[model samples]
Target: AQSVAQPEDQVNVAEGNPLTVKCTYSVSGNPYLFWYVQYPNRGLQFLLKYITGDNLVKGSYGFEAEFNKSQTSFHLKKPSALVSDSALYFCAVRDNVGSARQLTFGSGTQLTVLP
Candidate 1:
């Protein structure tokens, strides 16, 4: 079984400052991690993924995450924050060795960028 944990229910950041959303995962085999963002009444939008390559992976909208195998963590980071960046973020994980297309997602973290 695979699972993801986003400890924070909400993160508040000021516009122009850097922000980070924490995520951790657990899986039987090598994990395929992904990050997605969702807006009000919208489906999840793929942000980035860590399949097999550089530990530091960059994604849409200046977002990046580091895959730490030892810690079993993939934390999302943005150098600068924006008011429009505020949305619901999720961390998902799946077993790389399995063929299942389903992804186990975190509860979700609401990001609020104060203007």
Candidate 2:
């Protein structure tokens, strides 16, 4: 059984400062990592993915994540946080564990930006 763990339910940060939302996962086969962002009642927007190859993967909206094979972790990071960036962030894993291919969400991490 493969799943994602988001230790924090919420993360608060000041605008213009750097921010990070942690995520860790467990998968059987080769892991396919993904990051998505959601704005109040809106659909999730694909941020990035790491299927294979690189360790450090850059993504949309100045976001990026590092794929660590040893630790089995993928933490999303942004150099600078914007007030507009305040939203629900989710880390996902796409792997063939048993059933059909599906994205297992991290229960969401709410990022609150204080101006």
The best candidate in terms of TM-score: 1
Give the Å error, residue 19, model 2.
Answer: 0.5
Where in model 1 is the C-alpha error above 4 Å? none
RMSD of each: 0.8, 1.2
- Clashing residue pairs in candidate 1 (N, C-alpha, C atoms within 3 angstroms): none
Q: Cα deviation of 37 in candidate 2 (Å)?
A: 0.5
Candidate 1 lDDT, 56-114, residue by residue in tens: 99999999999999999999999999999999999999997677889999999999999
CA lDDT, candidate 2, residue 88: 95
lDDT of each: 0.96, 0.92
What is candidate 2's local distance difference test score? Answer: 0.92
The stretch of ten residues in a row with the least summed lDDT in candidate 2 is: 94-103
Best candidate, lDDT: 1
lDDT by residue for model 2 (12-44), tens? 999999998999999888789999999998999
